[model samples]
Each structure stands twice: as C-alpha cells, then as structure tokens.
Target: MAGSLPPLLLVGCGQMGGAMLAGWLADGLAPSVILDRHRDDIPAPHSVVRQASDLPDDFAPALIILATKPQKAAEILPSIAHFARHAPILSVMAGKTVGGLTAALAEAGTPGATVIRAMPNTPSAVGQGMTVCFAPPTATEADRALCTRLLSAVGDVAWVADEAQMDAVTAVSGSGPAYVFLLAELMEQAGIAQGLPADLARRIARRTVSGAGALMEQSGIDAAELRRRVTSPGGTTQQALEVLMAPQAWPATMEQAIAAATRRARELAS
Candidate 1:
C-alpha cells in the first residue's frame, strides 16, 4: 500500500466510480465513506450512507471525489460542499468543467473550491486505464500529487496545463476504448463472414487485438512501425492495410468521429 490516502469521501459508485473504487481497494487504500442513493452495488466493509445529511457531525474528509452522473451534478453538489471547503475536489463526471464545479461549490457555500476535472476510461476496472486531469490554479502541488496517486491506482495519470485540452482528452482516451471494441467486433463479424466458425472467429479476433496491444506496449514500438513489420510487399496484411488506409476510409473517419465527440463534450460543458 502506498502511504495511507487522505480520508476520502466518494459521492458515487456507479460504473466508472465503481471501477476506481475497486482499483483503490486492490491497492490497499483504506475504506472510504461512500454517499450514493443506491447502495446495493457498494461492496462490504466500506462505510456507506444514503444521504449527506446522514453523515456524522464531526466527520471530515481530506479529499472529496465527485463521480456522479453529469446530469446529477446540480442536485448533488450542494450536499457535498461542506466537505469541499476543506478538501480538494476531484471530479470524474464527463463534461463537467472545473469552473462549473467551482460555481456549484460556491452556491453550496464553499466559495472558490479547488476543483480538478478527470477523464478515465472503462479499462480502469482491469488496472490498465488512462486518466487525464486538469486542475485549476488554486490547486497546490500536494493537491495535484494526491489526485495523481489516486488516479495511478487504476492506471497511468497525465496532467494537462490547459483545461481547454480536456475536450480533446475526452475525445481521445475517454472514448478510445469504445473505438477499439468496435474494431474487435467488426473483425469478428468479418471472420465469420469469411467462413470461419463463429466461436473460432470470436476467439481469434479477441486474442489478436489484445495480443497486438500488449506487444505494442511491451516492445515500446510505435504502432505504425509494428504494423509495418508485419506487412510484406505482397502479403495479405499489406493488402488489408491499403484498403483500410484509403483517404475516405479509417483515417478520415476516425478524425471525424473524434471531432464529433469533442464537439459534444464542449456542448455538455456549456
């Protein structure tokens, strides 16, 4: 276990929040006081409360993590602002900007709260996640370090100086996993179409995608270089690459997809 994490107050335990909690537990973080309207999914041993008003009067958390759904932020922020006054706020809700969070906290009576925005992928459940965060000027070095340590439990942590870059971050790592999954799904369907048994197609597609990703990571090689090494001048791999890399194909489509996601993120923040 890394040194004990500051006393933590977690505001939600759904999908992404639950993944981060699982990672924290795996890393030996002490149980946190969790606040959620629905408590069935919360694991045993960590204290759970249904409402902020139910918290003991003397309770104080050193870090408060906001993981509620973006739509729920308006309703939940007021309940947590007491904790926000004394602790740095780490938020993983998609499209909730730091300025917006700060304003919510202020409305709850904790003015100028130090708010940090983070975007983490679903892979965090398996300890292979990518997390990018942007902190306001009010956040101190210690505050940033604490946030990094918390995020590192699930996977890698990156800090961006410009909060505006967060929209791009959301489009990339935050939504990248779904794109990879779609590729795997399409590959399996293609294999089945080519006369392979359904089970065999599924197994091969999953293994090939996972193995290639692992190899790329372990070898520290660029993806394009790795792809090149596998393609011979007249090989099947080269033929497939030529089709996929056409001007109107994957390269162009991927850029358009990311742009669409980035625009949605900006719209949500507004």
Candidate 2:
C-alpha cells in the first residue's frame, strides 16, 4: 500500500482518462470511484457510476480528477465542487486553465479550492506518457507531489511554473503523438510507392518509428546527432533528409503547425 496511489474520483473515462486509469490499475491504486457513462468493466475494489449524483455519500477520495471534455467543464465543475472542498482537483481537460476551473468551482460554492492542471497525451495507455503539470500557489507541495506520483505511474512527469507555457506544452507534447503517427503513415505510403509490398511497408515503417524512439530514449543521444549518424554524405538517407529538411519543408511546416496549435489552445482558454 505504500507505493499504491490514493483513492481517486475520476470524472470521465474517455480516451485520456481511461488511459491514465489503465496505468494506475496496473501499478496499484486504492479503491477508487469512476464516474463515467460509457464504461462498465472495472475489477473488484473499484466501482463505476454513471453520474456524479450516484457517487457514494460516505466516499471521500484523496484526489478528484476532472478528465471531462473542456466544453463540459462548466457543467461538470459545479457538480464536483463539493468534493473539491475535501481534496485537491486535478484537471486534465485541454485548454481549461486553473484559474478558470477554480472560478467555476467557487461559483458552485467551493471557493479557494486547490486546482492543478495537467496535459497528458494518449500514450498514457501504454505506460509511456509525457505529462506536464502546472499548479497554482494555493496548491501545497504535497499536492504537487501527489499529482506527480499518480501521473508518473503512467510515464514521465515535468512541471512548469509559468502557467502560460501550458499552451505551448499542449501544442508540442499533448499533440505530439499524432505528429509521430503521421510520420509513420507517410513513411509507409512512401515505401509502398517505391514498390515495396503494402504489408512489409507498414511493418517496417511502424517498427522504424518505434525503434528510433526507443533508441533515442535509451541512448540519451541528441536527435540531430543521431540523424548525422544515420545520414552519410550524399547517401540515400541524406537525399531524403535534404528534401525533408529544406527551408519550406518539415522545419517550417512543423513550426507553423505548433504555432497554430498553441494559438488554438489559447483561444480555448479564453
């Protein structure tokens, strides 16, 4: 029980929530309550309910996780404000700021509630997530540590003091997995176009992407250095890199993409 996560009240069980839940379950979580409409197959020691109203009256979770869609925050925050009085609220809703969520909870009768914000991607489902968190001044060191403990059960964890940076974090890491998957997709398509069999193309493309990621992590090498290692002068890899790394190619496109995503995140918060 020493290493186990404390009891939690998870407000949603959609893609992101479900992914974190899977990691917590695999590690060791205390008896928790999941408030979700579409989920039903949790094992013993945990319970699932369709709505917050159905939560057990005597149950008191150590932390309340608000993983609902950002659009539903206004509707969901008030319902869970009572719980916030007893426990810090950890919100995983995209584009929802700590101040905004805290204001909503206050309007619902719980003022000065400690609210922490986190951006976690879908890779959490595989226990390889990258979660970035931001906590307000009201949150205690213990609150931050609790969040790190719970989130790290899934993958790596980092924190930022400036809440404004969360928008860029959202653009880079929160939406980063899709970018990687897109790379794999393009590689597979290119392989097929080059006369490789479809099945082999898919397999090699996926493995190459995953393997490269693993190598980067395990070797702790700079990605540019790794690229240099792979790209011999005028070789096939160099030829491809030359095209991909052109001024108007991936470099510029990626910058524009992340800028667009960051702007959108800011817009959502507003």
Candidate 3:
C-alpha cells in the first residue's frame, strides 16, 4: 500500500458510493476522479467523467473503488482495469468474492490486480456505519491498512479471515438495517394498536429505537447485558420479552430470516 492514499478513482456514484465519497470529502480527501454514466451530486475538488475514456491520459489513482451492482461488474470492470496496475481495487458490492473480482480483472487481462471485498451498510451515510472487509492472501499489509483507512473514514470497520464469512456478513450487517427498520415499523404499529395516535406512535417508535441504539453504542455493554438492565425481574418489559423470546417468536424467526439472507447472498455470488 502507498504511504498515503493517492487520488481515488471511484467507478460508481450511487447512494452507497455517494455516501462514502461525501464522508471522504468531509475527511479532507480531495482530487478524486469519478467515472459513471449517470450524473450524481458530488462536492467540488472531485472531478466526474461520464466515461473512462474521458479521464486524462496522465491520471493514475492510488485506490480504485468498485461500487457498481454485481450484475454490471463485468460491463464496468474493463474500463477501470487500467487502474488496477498500480492501485488496489476495493469492492463494496455484495456477494462478489475476492476470487470473483480477480476473475473479472483477469477477464479484462489484468490478473495482477489486487482486490479487497467490503460489506458496508447504508448507515455509512451518517459516518456511523459498520463495514466488514476481507482481503485475499496476496494483499499486502499496507494494502489492508489502506483499506482500513478508507472504510474508517465512514465508520468503524472489522475484518474477517475467511471469505466465506462474507455471506454471513451480508445477512447480518448488510441486510441488518432493514431488519431494524422493520422492527421500528412493527413497534409503531403496535403502539397504534395500543390506542396511541398514529403520528405519535410513529415518532415515539422511531426515537425509542434510535435512542436505544445510541445508548447501546456508547454504553460499552453487550446487547444481552443491556437487555438485562432494561428488563426488570417481573416487569412489563420482561413480560414482553417472554413473548418475543418464545421458541417460535422473534429469536427463531430472526434466525430463519438471517439464514435465508445468507443463502441468497451465496446464491448471488454463484
């Protein structure tokens, strides 16, 4: 890896990519080149080109990010293969494994390209995202460190040794936000069922969930401990937990949901 990340070459500027680009800019990284067919609202100091050919002949980036959809990877990869000669490719696309990326580059005649796979959620937009990354054995320590810096710009980062674990990562954090959102939705509806006004229920549910999450983040306590702290010996919360933690209730259902998502992630990779 380079001592410092040089100018970045971002291949896509969709919602996720735009969030990261925004975080990087806010963190003072500038002089980046974005290659995308669709126009995106990007801050200044970062240039955007409609296509790879539009890039200046002399432009070389220290890092190249693959943020396009997995289905379009083959179509988008070739244009950026030139950057892989010097810069490492960091992919935020889900279900695309390291070998898959290497193969894509190989198909583009750039087998020497080093790639890292990252799974980051939408929360990255707020700089509080959880991003998990994996690098193949060929990636150098500096390469990993460079990726850590890049991911850390948006949020906390964790690394896994096994590439196969990425499927679980996808099921967990990758799709986890929607699960939380679903909880908020159900909570709001439940409040309404309990005779609360719809608008009040919605606001209360949203704030309660958000506040609990913030507390969990800052409290330096595990979720189980936090739950224990909140649930009295025989209180209403404990009563609710009895129902939610029932064998066929939330615990089992959540497990099944995550397992289904994990399977789908593997399916997409294949």
Candidate 4:
C-alpha cells in the first residue's frame, strides 16, 4: 500500500529495475530506499528516496533487489553490502552468480545475505513479462511469498528449486524477448518479399506480432489452442506452421540456442 511501511532497498535503477519499480508502484508497494549512481531516468515517486549513503534510520529491510549489470555488481557490492547483509538479495543480472556476490559481500564483513537469482525479460515493462526466480535452500516460506507478491506486479512469476536451472531460465525467458523481436524482423523482410512497400511492411509485421501477443494475453487458452484456431486444416497458416515447426526449423534451433545460452550462463557464474 502507498502509506504502508516499505520492505526493500533497490540498487541500480535501470530498465529491469525500473520495470520492477513501476510494478511495485502500480501495485501500491514502494521501496523505502532506492540507490543508483545516476537517477535521471527513473520516474519520481514521492515516497521512494532515490539516493542516500545508507538505508533509512528506520527498520532494516528484509530484502534488497539488485538490478545492476553483471560486470558492475562485483565492483559495487563491497560499498553497498552493509544494507544487504541483513536482507535477502534478489538479483536480475543475466550472468552473475550469488556465490560471487556472497564472496564479495563477505569481504566487506557483510555476510548472511540470502541470494535469489531472478531473470526477467523486457515485456515486464508492459506488465506481461515472465520472471523466473531461484532462491537459496534456506529461503523460508515467508520470504518466497513476499518476493512472489512483490514481483507479480511486473508479470507472472515462477520458482525453480534448483538454482542450476536458473541459467536455462536466463537463456530462455531472459534472452527470449529479443528472439520474438527477431521474428518481427524476419516477418517484415518476408512482407517486403511479398511486394509490400518497405515502411508498410514494417508496420504490418510489427502489428501482426503485437496483435498475436495481445490476443494470447486476452485469451485464456494455451498457445497450442490459439495456434490451432488460426491454423485451419490445409490452409496458409497451416502451411507456414509446417515449415516453422519442422525438426530443423525454429523450434530445434531455438532449443540449441537456449542450451548454448545456459552453458554460457554457467561459464559466467564460474
């Protein structure tokens, strides 16, 4: 609620963090303190104090949301670890691992910060994002519930018990939005091939993808059902589907791509 006590300290107010912040404000939960080196881009919320050397003199937060770049997190952790040590941390960085953060924080004498690795995609900016979270084994029921409620403001949230699967989460949902945009790109090119004007092709292609996505959101049915609805038997949509779903087509290639990203996730963590 707007006037209610805050539970979080957000570090790095970039795109992903901004998405989460927008979600929280929309849901009526605002962070008590938000810290970022540059505060220009964030929308001003009256209650959130964007920059202060330390957290407020009030009760310490139970959670800290980290949305900084992976490369910058290691550099920033030591300075900010004090506020985090007493709180569970949720990180949205793509490749950084909690272990590295833990070690870095420990060096600052700020130990015992529980880390929850989260991967959220760009769609979160519009409240239709998919967020996958992997919390430590010691994470309690209350902790999970708190995070689930906080993150749900952005979009749907799922939990993975094994942290090892988080890399795959990053590979899939984390990097998945760009793939959809890539589809739009190819669709535009296809329209150009069909002899439409370049600008018109671009508009049509963008609208087609956007409309399909909106339809999926409004319809309660699973994607398969929706596909079937559009794909009449022996029709144009069906023909396109046949090629798109082929063994060596987009599906298989996507699987391989996601796997590669997962491997890269592991490498980054190491």
Best by TM-score: 2
lDDT of 3 by residue, 1-270 (tens): 222335888888887788787677767774789987786566676789998788776787878998888888888888778779888999988898899889989889898799999998888878888999999999999999988988898899999999999999999998899999999999999999999999999999999999999999998799999999999888999999999999999989999999999999898898
The TM-score of predicted model 4 comes to 0.87
Say which candidate scores most in lDDT. 2
Model 2, global lDDT: 0.93
Q: By the lDDT metric, which is better: model 2 or model 4?
A: 2
Please give the clash total of every predicted structure, in order.
0, 0, 0, 0
Off by over 4 Å in 3: 1-5
Instruction: For each candidate in turn, give its C-alpha RMSD to the true structure in angstroms.
Output: 1.6, 1.2, 2.5, 2.7
Estimated TM-score for each candidate = 0.95, 0.98, 0.94, 0.87
Q: Which model, 3 or 4, shows the larger lDDT?
A: 3
Residue 187 in model 2: shift from native, Å? 1.0
lDDT tens readout by residue for model 1, 1-270: 743655688898788788888788777666568887776665555678888888665667778888888889998888778888788999998789998989888988999899999999888888899999998888999999999988888899999999889899999999899999999999999999999999999999999999998999889999999999999999999899999999999999999999999998898887
Error of 2 at 95 (Å): 1.2
Show where candidate 4 strays beyond 4 Å. 1-7, 41-59
Q: Rank the candidates by lDDT, best first.
A: 2, 3, 1, 4
lDDT per residue (tens digit) for residues 1-270 in model 4: 573425677888777888777667666654456777666554455334445554466647767888888878777787677777567888898877767777778887787777778898778877788999887777678778877877777899999887778898899888888888999999999999999999999998999999998898888779999999998899999999999999999889988999999998888776
Comparing 2 with 3 on TM-score, the higher-scoring candidate is 2
Q: What is the C-alpha lDDT of each candidate?
A: 0.87, 0.93, 0.87, 0.79
**Clash list (residue pairs), candidate 4:** none
Candidate 2, 225-268: lDDT as tens digits: 99999988879999999899999999999999999999999998
Please report how far candidate 2 places residue 36 from its true position, in Å: 1.1
